[model samples]
Target chain A: MKNNFYRAVYCSRCELIGSPETITAELQSILATSRRNNRPAGLTGALLFANNCFAQTLEGEREAVERCFERIQIDPRHSDVTVLEFGPAVERDFTEWSMAFVGDPSATSPDPLAVALFKDIFADNHADSGAKVLLLLRQLVHQEDLWAIA
Target chain B: MNQISSQPPIQTDDQNIARSVIRTTTSDQAAALRESFLVIEDGAILLDARLRVMLCNIPATIRLGHYGAPPSRGYPLTKLIAHSSALDADARTTVLDRCSAMSASDLAGIEARLVFGDIVIRIRRLALGRLLLWVPASRAAGESSLHDPLTGLGNRRVFQAALAAIFTKPNASAALLMIDLDRFKQVNDTLGHPVGDALLRLVGQRLRACLSQEDVVVRLGGDEFAVLLQHLDGVDALGKRLIDLLSRPYLVEGHLANIGASIGIAVAPSDAHDPSTLMRHADLALYDAKAAGRHCIRFFKSELNARAQARLALETDLRRATALNQFALYYQPLVDIASGRVTEFEALLRWQHPSRGIVSPAEFIPLAEELGLIVPIGEWVLRHACRTAATWPADVRVAVNVSPMQFSDSKRLICAVADALTTSGLPGSRLEIEITESVLMHNNAETLETLHALRALGVSIAMDDFGTGYSSLSQLRSFPFDKVKIDRSFVSQIDGKGGSGREVVRAIAALGSNLGMTVTVEGIETDAQADFVETSGGHQMQGYLISHPVPSDMVSALFSPQSPIASAPNPEPVAPAGSRRLRGHDHEK
Candidate 1:
């Protein structure tokens, strides 16, 4: 039997406390660590930080994806972590990047689109919000050339 | 204040700020230092030289509230300790005196450790006249180790503790309820874990809503919960209410999920005095509730325990009986209606326990199935029956009954059949495999593939105990069975009253014949039943009216060339009653 490919999306309240610069540094370190870990595990995904919330999607073999998600759930920097979607998928949407990050944490003003999408995710308590997050991530990654593909 | 700044700075970055805040004694610097402490996961509180609260984080405020001494900026530490309901008067005075008497040297390390009920608070001195107090996150979150994170209910540890506490008081009247959710696995498998988790949380909320605060409810594990009821007066009503409430549909994560609860109740000091015994009794009753069907409740009884003990002994005997070769197969003849000749014999397993004599298949077959011994036993029956039938006339086929468990692994079953045929040197055409509708209910594709493979080997398939299970007609339409055996229930219902039972039998026989399948009416204990079956278009009849299932050695004697049954094509039907005592006659004995 072929290995089942899965994608999981979750949003959590960002518990990291500090000035914007400190939080930006923390987010950059998170992106770097995720890239280093995800490549060896055959995982590819994107992370978004805006409005004091973090939404991320991980896509890989089912077991690897679930293991990475479990680790993220226990990380002290995130709380109220809610999984939006977790199931077998036909194909990977973020295949080019091991960990693609979409938000400028150091910027004085948060990205309006990312912040709006995060607001909608928190406001809507339905399963479709996970799909909406995936669509938003796919669109943001395609629209912006600033994100590093590592 | 300037004296603190002149001293050597702490090695850690955050601690350096702690030293500076104490030296400068500036409100702005203190606020920045408090902002840095927010990054720490533990609850943090800063105290001034007078041991008054200066700054606190959100976690610290929450923890303080839990200890019944909510903190505020500028609040005196002694007053906070005095206000705590968690601490007795002596503990409060001890904590206050310890804090007030701390020397400048003592402020450089952990100054005081205070226990308030289950919560512990640790005080550390950051600098001269500056102390930091905080609670570790693990111990601070309402003692999270004793709670289930998803539902906010107590965990198994809490259940054990509560049970132990109840038993500590002699003559305490309490009831334990073991609840298991039905169809929960289906939802988890189909909807994914998020929805399943959400459903569990909703179930927890509903359970809490049904009972009073005095009753303790805990999520024991996945889809299993336990409730400790202090009052036993309305325990039955509460169980019923729980069943009704849990059975209601739940909308979880945009999906509508339906599930049910089965509860088993055991009361303390009456059913059992010890925690382990009470738990076992509740679990046994839970098994009974589940076996009785979902959404039901059962109470512990002494007879249930006796029955459980008996079953354990029987299971042990069955395991040994299989190894000791204590099982035998009795053959029952199926007579052709038109020619009144025995064309086939169905193989039936009988267990002869050493001391118990003959054990009914009705009692042991289910146990064997549950124990997963049916596969090997079923194979043995096939091989043995084929070996016996190899000596019979070439045209008389032998039928062997197959349990649904045997079909779980189609490859093993097919291999067993092929092996039996090859080893016995019996032709596949001389063997028939009998199965019930349950064999086709699950893994339909695999079962069908196995059936086709068996047919390829030239063995016929028969649907046994037909019209008993649901969707018998649909099952017949799904596959082209060579024979359909009408269950004995309808045959026994034929009292010559021309009721629906007679009509049902006639309709099934007609339906079977119309489908080009042979119909065999079983359990015909009288002439009337046999006559009804013959006139109802049944092709074959097998029942007590012909003869009781006889040993393998006696099967051939009944149909030998010299016997009256073999010489006469339409011989007299065997006596319906007391046929077991009429063993002298060679034919129809």
Candidate 2:
């Protein structure tokens, strides 16, 4: 039964062809829709979108995770959908949110730090890129919580 | 109405609408009605006159929840589309519009259908302005017909759809790889179907893990699979990676299963623009890969198509050749070094093509084997050789090469040999059946039993083309053979340069002798080669140096009293001395 718990990570370039406002609305819609769908499927994950690039991780039962990934891969809004990692996981990292957002949705400009991390991850064909993305998202979430408290 | 008075009350509130509808029935009738509605495989939701969710079963609740709209009693039905993840924005708007505009009269129709993504829903009117929404079980299970149920990979339908989608764009460059698993049948036969199924699922996972998300992998059914790549760059590396990953051993159901993959690739716009042609080219390349030996990758080449065409034509010709009497047996004498006389004549098959003259056995034998024509052709050779050998001296034996296919059905093979001996009126002792190491490599008990049966018929078995296949030494120790024929490559290597080839021939000759088997060195094309065979303790020498394989009529001329070959020609006087000394040494034994 433990072997059934799986996690998958994928990164893609945003191909939402529209104005800035429309792209922002599309991005928000993706997050809201995925959250609504993931809750019923018992899937927990986080999405990081910045500089017209997106990296996401989903964790759940193997079948659920794979089905969710399949839908994401076919979505017209994403291009060059590269699967970085897909294997069994010991435990979930983002159990609190159905789909936690990592960057500000309303910001007109991209976050420089998030954009830099995206470039680093995509530029090198390293096997650990998925792990690196997960670590970055977890740190960012913790920092945001600290800021909210302050 | 009287039936409703006798019915018991329904236990679940979800069936309240059913209870209300059947209120006039007896208590038993009401309970049965409720049970029947609940037991229906399709999800059913009852909506009130205002399109409110008046009642629903567990199937409906689960199906709605999967679309992100878990229905509750009294929840407005039109609001479900707003929260549905199964539908896009346009589909949601369309569904909402259709529901809001529907009149009570429109709901009275047989069925009002709605489609969003792969889900289909049908709404039908019930009595008293109530409407029932039916979601078939197939959609409720969330499994599309495009998927393989066992592996969750896309099925052939999905593959065809993806292929058509690719070609819709002009100037598109993509590649298709056709993969077949080797030794999977053996695994299934040895380990059972459960393990084979588990291994296939694991194979699908490994294939998906190695490919990009943009690429599509599908189970083409059974142990064969295919992949469609969006780009042609790095295709070779991807093919090699797939072969490597799939060939790794799989542990399934407490059993370790080992299988290998052979890949054939065809690139679009280069191999062919259309889908069917591309698939055919890939299949042809796959044939080449499997023929080249399993666990390798082959790319589609224009020449492969041509070669395939040629092979097809040759196959047709081979099929007719057997019945047309175009096949003839050529006899090549194996000279005994000790007596300097012909002891046995190996019957070799030659295809006397009308236009092509004599086609080499090397070219057509494998083709015959693949087409399963080897068995009948082998029977013909056996019969012809036996009849011809009966006319020769009684001491002279005839050796006919038997293909591995002939051994597949040992009963038929034994019957064929028996029929040949009986019809030809030749003793079985004079007929030797020569088999290669491959026959023993299969290691089937049936083959061993067949060998014993043949020996029981007073026939001698020779291990032909030895030292060429793997585990030759072990094979000799396992089966007691009458003779061992050293492959021609070793004899061609004996140039007196004295490399390992000479030492190898010498060692094998000594091994065969110690095992109480006759050793014949093949391809002795030179006088020096003959001298070397004599010195290395070989019993017989067979090659052009002995004589070219002649027709059956000419076989008698070779043994005639005045024959130059039978007179022990004066090619080299010193060579005779070694042969004479070996002859004397053999007499002592």
Candidate 3:
């Protein structure tokens, strides 16, 4: 792992706002599914959402990480994934592994599902986990279409 | 009378009721209602004033047994309640009385919490007759506005309103309890929202179970709840309830989650009279509790708020105290134990508040520190005390008490001391700085380096309030100090009046000698305390017995040969070994 890429993620969900829980839930599922399939590959990423944007950097095995990124980009629940960092990930970037999460206070909880999801994430303290994917999920989770809010 | 009295109940004379029935029902309406009111008598069912099913509703009939005949007629309201064992009969009667007596204008005084299975219902009195209308108070059942959608407890707005009502009631008392879930976000990140929500909902239920009927629990948005306990039973009891409630494991998904609420409470009217103010104070107390540790509960204390308010006032005053020349240094003479002559003086800051007649530094020094004004206040004290004492006799070094903020405040402090020394024309060697052990520990590197730089200017440094810090011996080795002032707490106890002040003074004196620094006993006001220190190998002393802190004008008078407070000319000198062995025991007592 190299220190060059600072290991951070940013994204604008397909919508105008984001939900911290949805992004985190999707990230956890995607990472969990990816890890179950790929051997010797442990995925690590950070999710950040600000000003209606979702961005993150997932780093692990080249193939595992790229596949995770693909899910974030095309998973109808999310869209408009822009890669902010690429290259070898830092060895102790996370020190261990964690989901850095918080509500995009910049935006209110979006829809009933988004609101319920946000409330659940916050109440459970998992608002900070799965943030890598939540950055997009918080915004795109309830949107009827990806490009509508964006 | 009813109009003028705010808390007055609905005044009824027969006119109001008769008028309501006549106006609402009309002359022919009573006949119509008597005929159509029978609509409540369908399917062996009944209706009462509150419209609660006097008999079971159709859906309820399958599970609950039904009543026969015109059920619109009254039955004991208690029989309608399910799971009668959960609540006492007296509680049901009180709910009935309040609801029956109150007009439809208010329901607050007649609400009862009815627990049916796992669901909690808020039942209000129905006005037409003796009846109760029940709705689940929990947000899970669709309560809006009053409850936080997340915590399922009353929201902050409602809590604020509750506090206001409680405070405004004359003779009313309550404790404002603030609760914050510690590190809750960590759970959200590591687990998932589903599990997280499960954890939060569990916490809410647990906290709810901890509350008594007299208590009101409110959720203030995220991870925080305020409980208003009117005439709280006892802090220990409530605290025990919280601990015991959270003691159980919350099963979030497959794994059990662990988290706890840090609670801080301020008693109403005692801590604060205003609602928002009390709420805020409880919040501050809660924050402090959380900072102290999780899974803890603390009651609001006046001293904390006093210290806070005092700090703010002092911080503001200190800035003005310096600019307006309200700061003055009072010197207390440090006597040479053997010569009985004033050799050095400790400089203290006094604030002449226009309204608060001569505010003592003991009360305001801490206030200054809290406000971050200690750095500037300390500099003023150091510079001014040195400037004023510059005219004293050459050997009389002035010791200015320095705060930790000043010592660790970068090299600028060293320069300020130098400036004071240079500007006053007082030799650096003639000035000494007194600092507490905390000053060194707060930021040792800067304090040590700063002390060395001041030493380079020829000023001596003495550790003030020596006994109060940790790892004293190592700290002694780490710093380059010239003297140590035995803490006043120990010196005041030096007399064998109650404890072993002799052994303490001896050990401290021995430590100072071995460390190669002058050992001074401070606050030696009594003759016995002075004799004890000298006999115990203490080298120097400073106290009121030597002389109280005085202005610059009194220094010349006290030290002058023929002045009123001056000691005898050519006072007899005493030796270290002989003085300890033969102190005039008569003079000692």
Candidate 4:
């Protein structure tokens, strides 16, 4: 099978801040769409929002991830266009996702921990932290190494 | 043929000149040989038995010219040689002869000083055929080992000694200026180090030009030069002069360069009497001056020590406070003034310091910001508040106050908000973040993006503490806000007790309405204030009027269903109700 590639981008306006309402709707839509047609191309990684800047690690093949990354730029949600970190080939670090969303839960709230972890940590602002927790979960999930079980 | 026919005419002069040179050690034969002889103006031999000039240089041409013009390029030992025997002669020749004769003997030792003009020539023996070099001792005595090769000025050691002496003298005062050229490294890196070297030399020259004869300059090594100003009455005057000297721009290789001085001043008998102590104090002051901004001058101050101590104290406590779990969140209700209904609450963090007990956000907020701990601390607050609020009624939202530090970063804000929501299982809509008006002043795009990100996740956002910042109309159109909260200042004065408070409130409430934002008034204390807000079409009013910030355990009673309702609500009111201010006063330090 041929491999695919995706290019990352940054938005200047969105870099500063997004109104909670706008961010919420945008994230909900992204999640809903990804959930509808679920597959590896639905893969998305961590999202980090800090210092009026936003960063994320999205994955799948080049086409799928690039399409997702492109929507982030022109979404009218953010504007500044200084791509902080990008590589045409960093490899989709996150393969397990159908548009997982992590955001400031203050905009979203109370649910069971597992479900909240998705909308609260993945698709939104809290994505970075949630990703960290995911990493921990990954460590404990499947392990041929003894360290993983321990 | 043997040695030019056994002690030939030139050979005799060579022997005499070699004898005159003095070598310190017998170990180095080459140096001994090089220094042994003096080339003179006349070719004549001064021997052990007699005295004469030996091994003439070009200067010998002049002497030969005087000897009847060309004198056959040679002179006999007795006729042209002026000096007499060993003792009566111009002693230089006699000493040379004596040294040579000693070196030839089985074992010999001798020393002699023969003066010519201002030069002192010393003679010592090596082997009988050779003598060591003789140089003028006076020139050596006046020479200084501490002179900088390039500047030819006193180095660090000499400056320290001079400063010590100056300090020890009573009534003496001096100021030390430490010149630190800012961005000098850039010049070196960009233009090449050669240019940087030239710039340094140029600075050295310019500084020297600034000093008087009485003042001393020292190249204390690499871009750091010092000037000691004597006869200064006090540090203030000294600092002024030093600043002036360093303020002038220097032209290096046709490039105009500006360098500033962080001058440290010390007055003798006043600041300190010891030289090193004064220098240390001056250095400390210089550090402070640099910290204030480059190009500033400051005098040694004893109070800086106290400030240093205070900074250390604050930094230490900030680190420890979190570990001790000394923090707690307090909630202030946000009432819909028009309806007189409580809709939301603002979460404010307070520290119950073991010693201070209930420190205000104002006191520790800046400290946290400085230490870069506000992000972590804010994350904690957001999570705690969300979790607590999650346990509240479904429609009730908690407003967590976000400082400039907390919201300045998109990544951190995302993490904190996500963590708060995820960990607490609180719905995004139920979680509202309150950011101050000042937060909108910078990096608009980033703030907007972060806000939008948070908002898109179903969270509500509000502009907090309005009317007290650089209020820009553009902010309202650009940033999406569910509500605009008026400052407590205007609310506190709205009873018409103070100047123009009611009018300001009236105007702000109108503005918020015109902009289509839910207007919340903060810090309302009395019923009259509450009444004024209710009449003003304000959407929300919060303060001591309805309920002060209370703990989780008392929330049910504090925000009770139907008590003191100027108006009624759609949902059935829950449990017991009463406004109970804590035993301690509101500590918004």
Candidate 5:
């Protein structure tokens, strides 16, 4: 695909209604399924799981991206599904990570964007939520690498 | 001549052929330069015009693998280096453009920098493609910029990196100590920056000596040092030792300079796990230590954050209160002992916070002073008091407390006072400026001159909260005053038993009389307290026993001779649970 292709970036947070192992199992399966389903569809994104919540950002062709979110919204493994941000972008922020995963069981450190999004979607006193979410996901990806190594 | 011309032409032709041969050799040498870059310490990656990694040296491959997965030949450079979040959207765009179709003139000599943790990658366009050199961020400082120049201790950046490393180590529990030097500014002001610098070096050395070999000491800029302790049993004994060692007097450039250290500690895994949050919590604890009177130590507790948030909320509210004109002055009648009548009304600050109803001045004044909001707030209080007291009887003076910060700039204070008096048309005699002994402790000749000038303007000055601080006697002798208010501490202790409190009160009153100054005894909350003040030769009595501070509208009624409450013989309850009397505005430090 050409680099100038338009894509939709969407982030949602939902409560993980299962044990840490079960969540981990479900996440691994999701990653397996996503990489399989997204490679031909030209989709790329990242998934971050801290505490008992899941924050995922999806970027792809607008229709394909929306279709993927539809499956996630109906998934029984999670509850309290709420979309934090949805918008059209010039390019994909997570082009390299087709399905990067971050799962921190002792995730006591607060994520500024996650807190704001969960509390109120429109209560972003900071103007640029999309950029902040992108950076936050990127940080989570780095942290996930560290967690894997540990 | 013909033969020479033929030789010159032949030489010219040979010279041209030699130049062409030299050019071919130089081109061959240019192709060999690529392999020579492999030995450099920095990571090197050479790319083709199509943006594929053509060559990745050993260091570059290691760094790429460190970030994520290493790239092989023909792999995209962007994908290989996309693991770091610090290279945000703009950097990504520039990297791609410089590799592809960006004009040579656009990016001609400029190199794009991508910072990933401690590694800084410099990307510049080569003749055919792009070259990226990844060097350690500290290379600009010759590889060891982690230590502070003045103290030879690690700088803040090193401390932060160490904190991060601790968090990554499994089962590692450490304590972060944030220590700040107290009265260091005074040393600098009195001695000089060179002396101050020497004192800092001495403090750093002492801190180092107090720590174990495993502990990392960092000079976090300007009298603030942070220590990370590992494999420690408890931080209490170490904290005590640090305080003692840091508080000792230091010989700096032949001058003995004294400074104290306040430490705030946060234990890892309990208080916080992350470096920034841990540092912040320790800093909050440091603030608490400073608040609890310097030269102390405090450990981080969950409640500290809530208290800090509460303070932040109050600070925001105070700024709004000033803007909305929500502050008012209450007048406590300073009455004559013999006449049983109000002589002066001490104007006390009262903040009508929108929701909290009445926020105590004791709670907000120091905060305001710290926030640098006191000057404007003080100006408002002075003008409001002068304007309100202008309506009162001319004989009843109005006393307004002035903070030391306000007096720092004597010109501004003088102008404010002059403006208030001039605009209100209130005689300077009816305006009294109440100042504590600490205000005069600076002993600045200019401050004394400012005081004398204020006195010369016919305005009365009272030595407020007297006998509560050092140099009370010396201040009384050095500065001219129209009145002296015995601090509430001594008055609260006075009774018929007559101990040091009564003796001290008697001596102060006698001294005030001897100097031809009116003496006002404060905190007289009972009949016995009032009687003690009268018998002890007090000229005026100011306390709840006389009259609780009433708002401006009630001032006229209190000062009226016909009003029975003004001179009530049996005073009401001194301090009801919710009475304003309990919210006395005491100076904090």
Candidate 6:
């Protein structure tokens, strides 16, 4: 078989809207569908809900990753979807799960990275906002508190 | 007493009948409430909807006797308490207006304290139009305990309790004002706490005078006060007024002192509904107000919270900025007009934030200073710029800005600069350290000594942003600076026909030359501006007209053979005494 696919990592941030019950239900459904859909496409990543915002990193074939992001941009449960980073990666950052979840779906405990990311996004002085946001997400994974099995 | 003497006392048999009637008709809970009301030593009374006195304990009868006759069943409650002088006028009106507006089923409650001469009576309007009044047994003790002994203001405990009571009501709209007095510690440290105590008392008195009677003010321990204003829509103007009022000079024990207050206002039903959240929000606003240079009012907003969180995030990122190798140095050339060649390059700091792309120094420099990260970052920039500039043609000097904060510890900065020069194999004379006027404003021995030592090491010292500082000429005379960069403001206005801006630049350039120093005019863009600098005796010029700040990799081309600086022929062969030639280096070619 000819190796014809290139892997890319794409991350985006969005504000989660709706009540806790609705948001949790929506998140659960999203995870279920994302896992079911991404497994066949070999896409894997983690979704973090904190401070009413989501930071997700998806790694897979470049075409599949871009397509997944296209669907997420129009998702009704969230708004202000901003792609912080998108590029080829040597390997998967979230290889264990297709759609891992960090932080509670109901938005109970504050997402530590959300505050950091929001600051960078809205900063008047800082430049290279997207890369700083990616670093913040990478920090979350390194911290190990944000990881969900699947 | 006169009214009590006129009216007949309640018959003992009538009281017994009323108690037995209450015991037979009311449930165990009601009976228990009535029994407890009877046994309390403090004055106790219960009134019905029609102002009828349904029950009065012995203490209540004795207390009521002062204003009117002892109350009995069917006696009008309002008439009995009409003569009391201690009921606050404002509270009286509020209770009366609210009582008429409320419906029969509405279970609204009101708390008020009525002072009966030496005693304080606590009154609460309960459900079913029942009015409960009781004098706290330890009223004197309670008053003292609730107040700060030093300032005589309600203490933190009292404020918290008041907040809790206010939170229980539905649709309560108010503003929580958090106040912090600036420079109180300095007063305390220098003049001592006794004077500080007096100043605090004065602050409380001024604060109390500015507020309405209904507003509750509490001293939240150590130069902090919280004021809870009921039914207030916005407190911005009021907060300003309070800050102005509190900031006035105070005479504490024959010593004149000054202080200012920063206020943060958080509104109810908007910022937060609960007490703790409201307090936190108010405190957060206070932090912003203080950060914005104190002595001002800041209202809590979602954006303010976001900005504060962003600031915190930036601080974290700044700590890691150097560690992650996210910082870079950009170079902008400084061209000697006479020679039409690059004399030196200014190394500007840039943060290539992983997400933010290229963070401006304007935004992160101050933040890094606040986080105490500037020293290390400055060290990194110094070393990196020096090392990079070392690879350039030897004649091209590299100038790096030294922040005042970095220069604050002159020893460490001097050591770092020395280390950088030694490690990069760059001659001390090839490096220029640009310092603003504020850096020399301190004029301390250590800072001056540091400058002299660097000069002794053959490093060129430049007074940056001249004509903008407090003492430019006197400072020039005071220190042997090798160069002076006329500020960009004066340079931009040089083309403004016969403007003082041009005159100032000309005079500064003349002074630089007279003092045996090279003058570099900054921010020269237009030809008219460049001509003004050239004719005005400005030795060197730097700005976008030459070239915008570029990455480190692009710096060498500006000095390369056949480059802009290399191609422009020198109009005059006049070189300063030190004579650092730009294009004469044949070794690098």
Task: Please give the range of 10 consecutive residues that has the lowest summed lDDT in model 3 chain B.
Answer: B20-29
Model 5 lDDT per residue over B66-93, tens place: 3433344456767855753446666556
Model 1, residue B519: distance off in Å is: 1.5
Could you give candidate 1's per-residue lDDT for residues B1-589 as a string of tens digits? Answer: 2322222233424333333332312233233344344555556666666887655555654555534323445567877666556567887787666666552445333345667776666654433345556565655553444568899887774565456545534666889999999999989978999989988988898787777645678899899999988657999998998887677555455455778899999998799776777889999999899888868999999988998999999999998987898999999988878776677889999999989899999999999999999999999999999999887776677999999999998999999999999999999998999999988887788999999999988999999999887655889988999999989988888975655668888898889899999999999888877767778989988888786898898777445232233222532333223222223244432
Candidates 3 and 5 compared: the better one by TM-score is 5
**Which structure among the candidates has the greatest lDDT?**
1
Which CAPRI quality tier does the interface of model 3 achieve?
incorrect
Docking class of 2: incorrect
Deviating ranges (above 4 Å) for candidate 1: A1-150, B1-153, B168-171, B182-201, B251-259, B291-294, B560-589
Q: Which stretches of candidate 6 lie over 4 Å from their true place?
A: A1-150, B1-174, B180-201, B211-225, B230-237, B249-261, B287-296, B441-446, B453-458, B469-478, B560-589
Candidate lDDT scores, in order, read 0.75, 0.75, 0.57, 0.57, 0.69, 0.70
- List the DockQ of the predictions in order: 0.02, 0.03, 0.01, 0.01, 0.01, 0.00
Question: Model 3, B1-589: lDDT tens per residue?
Answer: 0111212123444343222211111122123222222232221122344433332222122112322211122333445433234345554465445445542434345344444444344443322332333332242552443457776666553454345445334445777777777767767767877777767766776676656544677666666666777675686577656754554334344343556668888876677766666776886787668657767887777666785686567677677887888878787767666665567878888888888789977777876876778888788877887887777766678898878777656687888899899988889998998878887665566667788888999999998877765637777778767998888888877766675767877898898889898889888778888778778787888777666787765555445232222222432222132222222223333
Give the alpha carbon lDDT tens digit for every residue of B242-315 in model 6. Answer: 87667644544534566889999898878886777789899999998998999999889898878878988888
TM-score of each model, in listed order: 0.57, 0.58, 0.45, 0.45, 0.57, 0.52
Q: Which docking category, incorrect, acceptable, medium or high, applies to candidate 4?
A: incorrect
Q: Is candidate 2 or candidate 4 better by lDDT?
A: 2
Candidate 2 structure quality by residue, lDDT tens digits, B1-589: 2333333343435445333432322223124333434565656665656777644555654544434324444567777556555667787676555554452555334236777666676554433344556666665443444468889787675465456445534556889999999999889878889888988988898888887545778999999999988788999998987886676545455444568899999998789766777889999999999999878999999999899999999999999998889999999888788777677789999999998789999999998998999999999999999989888776789999999999998999999999999999889999999998888756368888999999999999999989996745878988889999999899888885655679989999999999999999999888888878889989988888767888887676455232233223322221232232211112233
In model 6, the Cα lDDT at residue B7 comes to 28
What docking grade does candidate 6 earn? incorrect
Clashing pairs in 1: none
